[model samples]
Target chain A: MNDERLERYARQLLVPGFGEAAQERLGRARVRVVGADAVASAGLVYLVQAGVGRLWIEDAEDVSPSDASGWLFAPSAVGSPRVEAARAVLAPLSRFVSIEPYPKGGVPTATLVFASSGPQALASAEAARRAGIPHVVVEPDAEGGALVVVPPGAPCYACARSTAGAGRPAQPGIAALSALGAAELVLMIANPESTPGRRIDLVRGVATARPTSRLPGCACGGPGAGAT
Target chain B: MSASAPPRVDVRAYACPMTYVKAKIALERLAAGERLEVWLAAGEPVENLPRSAAEDGHRVLAVEPLAGAPGAFRVVLEKGAGAAPEWP
Candidate 1:
C-alpha cells in the first residue's frame, strides 16, 4: 500500500485482525447496495469510507422529497434517479471507492440490501444467497431496525429474519442500524471464517445479536444450500 | 547472543493512532516470532505504541531513545503466535 492509502486507512489498520490484508480485501471488493434512499445512506457512506472498492447501487426509483432527510441526498436531487443521486454524494467521500449505478449482469462479490419493502428484501437476499455470496439485509422499523448477516455456507436471510416486526415510518435511528449493517458486511468480508451468520436487532439504543438457525424444512439446510 | 536486523519503520511524522497503525502494519508483514523496529516521536506516540502493540499480542522487546535523536525513541516488537482479534 502507498503512503497516502496508509494514511487514509490508518484508523482501521489499528483494529486488530484488520491490517493490510483485510484492507486489501476491502479494496478489491465489489459490493452491491440494494437501496439508495434514506435508510441506505449511512450504509453507503460507511462502505465507501471503509474502502469497498466498487459499489453498484441498484435502485430504479427516483429520489423523493423524503429522501432529503437523509444525509446523502440533496433537496435539488429529488427528481433524479436515486442511484445517480447516491453516486454523486458517495463519490466525494472516498477516492478509493468507485460508486456507480448497478449495471445489468454485473456480479458483486458481496451485497447489502436495504430494500424498502419485505418482498424486495426477500428477493435480493435470496438472489445473493443462491449466488453463494455474503450479504447483509436491513429491515428498518420506527423503533430501530434489524440486520440479517448471511455469510456463504451459513443460514439464509429468510431463515434468520424476524417475523414479528412490522415496517414503520423511517426514524433517525435507522441510520445507526444501517451503519451497523455495513459493519456486519465489512466483518464478513474482512474475516469470513470468524464471522458467522447471525441476526442483529437494534432496538431503541441496545443491540442484540443471535446466531441464525435454519427453520425446519427451510431450503437453506438442504444439500443444495449455497448452490448457485 | 545471535542478532538479526529487524524491519524498521519511521513514524515520527504521524500522530496518535497513525504511529501505531504504521507499526502494526509493519508487524503484520512479519511472520510469527519476527521482530519489528518502530521509530517514533516522544510523548503519546512512544508511550502508547508499545502498550497498543502488546495489547494486540505482540511482545515489546525494548523501548529506548534513539542515538543522538533527543525526544525520539525506537520500539522493538516480537510478533506473537496468537491469531488476530476476531471481529463481531
Candidate 2:
C-alpha cells in the first residue's frame, strides 16, 4: 500500500491482528450494503473506513434531514442518494476503495452482503444465496441491535430471516444498533472461529447471549439446503 | 399561519416505499431547502420512509406519532440546501 493509503487507515491498521495482510484482505473484499438508512449508516461507514476494496450501496430513497440527525450522516449530505453520499464521505478517506451506487433491485456480485434495508434487500440477498455467496443480515433496535451472519457453507440470510420472522421488509431505526450489528457481522466474516451453522442471539444492553443449532427439516436444511 | 410558510402535504395515509415516493415528489417540486411537512399514518413507512428520505439526502426535521392517533406521525421533511436529484 502507498503511504497515503496507510496513513488514511493508520488508526485501524494499528490494531495488532489488522496489519498489512488484513488490510489487503479488506481491500480485496467486495461488500454490498442493501439499505443505506439510519440502521446501516455507521456499518457502511465503518466498512468503508476499514478499506473494503469495493463497496456497493443499494437504496431507492433520497436523504432527509432527520436521517442526518443520526451520527452516521451529516446534515450537509441531506437530499443525496445514500450510495452517492456515502461514496462522497468515504472517497477522500480511502482511494483504494471504490463505491458503486446502485438503485434498489440490482444485486451486484459480492463476497459478503449486509441487509439493513429491510425486506427489499432480502429478496436480492436470496439471489446472492443462490449464487452461494456468504451473507450477513443486521437488524438494529433502539435498545441495541441483532446481527445474523451466514458464513460460507452456513445457512443463508434468507433462511435466517425466515427463521427469525424478519424475512419481510420493515422500518428503520437508530444508527448505533445498526453500526454495532454490522461490526459484529464483519468480525465474524473476517474470522471463522467457532461460529458456523451456529445461531447466536444476544441482548447487548443486558449482556445476555445464547447459541443454538438448527433442527432437522427446519427449512435451512443445513449447509446443503437448496437455495430458494 | 405564518405568511412566510407554504401549505404542507400529508403523507401519513401512505405506507413504506410510497411514503418515500410521495415525499420525493413533493421535495422535487419544492424550491431548494424548502420544507415539506408530511403526515404519515402508523406502519412500516414510519421506519422505512424517513430513512429513505435521509438516505436520498433530504432533511427530516421530526418524527412523532399524532395524539390519540396511534401509529400516525407528523414528519417535517426539508429539502437540502442544494438542488434535488431527478426522481427515479
Candidate 3:
C-alpha cells in the first residue's frame, strides 16, 4: 500500500482481525449495487467510504421528492435519474472507487441490494446468488428494518428474507440500518469465508441475528450451488 | 542460516496511528519471528508505537533515539506468530 492508501485506510487497518490484506480485498472488489434511491443512499455511501474498487449502480428510476429525506441525495437531486444523481454525490467521496451505471453485461465480485420494492430486492438477490457471489439485502421498515447477509453459499437470501411484503413505510433510523447493511457487505467482500448467511432483524430499536437455513427443496440446495 | 538485520520503515513524517499502521504493514509482510525496525518521531509516535505493537502480540525489543535525526526514535519489534489485537 502507498502512503495515501495507508492513511486513507489507517483506521480500518487498526481493527483487530482487519489488516492490509482485508483492505486490499475490499479495494479490489467490484460491488454491484441494485438500488440508488433514498433507501439505498446510506449503503452506497458506506460502500464508497469503505473503499470498494468499483460501484456498479443498477437502478433505473428517477429520484423522487422522498429521496431528499435520505442521507446522500440533496433536495436538488430530485427529478434527476437515481443512478446518476447518486454517482454525482458518491463519486466525490472516494477517488479509488470507480462509480458508474451498471453495464448490461458487467460482472461484479460482490453485490448489495437496497430496493424500494420487494420484488426488485428478491430478483437482485437471486441474480447474485445464481452468479455465485456474496450479497446483502437491506429491507427498511418503519423505525427499523432487516438486512439479509448471504455469503457465497451459506443459505441464499431468498430463504433468509422475511416474508413481509413490499412497501414497508420508511421511517427514522432507516439510513443507519442501510449503513449497517453496507458494513456487512463490506465484511463479506473482504473475507467471504468468515461470515455465514444470516438475517439480522432490527425492530423497535432492538436487533437480533440468526443463522439462516436452506428451505426444503430450494434450488439453492440443488447441483452447482454452495459455490464457496 | 546467517541472521541478517531486520527490515526497516521510516514513519517519522506520520502521526500517532499511521506511525504504527505503516509498521504493522511491514510486519505483516514478514515471516513469523522476523523483526521490524520503525523510525518514528519522538513523544506520541515513540511512546505509542511500542505499546501498540506489544498489545498486538509483537515483541518490542528496543526503543532508542536515532543518532543523526533529532527528536526521532527507532523501535525494534519481533513479529508474533499471530496478531491478537486486544478486544473490549
Highest TM-score: give the candidate number. 1
Per-candidate iRMSD: 3.8, 19.4, 5.5
Candidate 3 Cα errors over 4 Å, as ranges: A165-168, A203-206, B1-4, B84-88
In model 1, how large is the Cα lDDT of residue B73?
98
lDDT of 2 by residue, B1-88 (tens): 3435754767665554455655665666666567877778777877776776776677888888777777678777777755334322
Task: Estimate, for each residue in A48-158, the C-alpha lDDT of model 1 and write its tens digit.
Answer: 999999999999999988888877888999999999888888898889999988889999999999987888989999999888889999988888978999999888888
Please rank every candidate by lDDT, starting with the best.
Answer: 1, 3, 2
Relative to the true structure, candidate 1 reaches a TM of 0.94
lDDT of each: 0.87, 0.60, 0.85
Chain A only, candidate 1, TM-score: 0.96
Cα lDDT of model 3 by residue, A18-51, tens digit: 7788898988899999888787888898999888
Query: What is model 1's C-alpha RMSD?
Result: 2.4
Comparison by DockQ, 2 against 3, better one? 3
Highest DockQ model number: 1
TM-score of chain A of each: 0.96, 0.73, 0.95
The per-residue C-alpha lDDT of model 3 at residue B36 equals: 91
Worst 10 residues of 3 chain B by lDDT: B79-88
Docking class of 2: incorrect
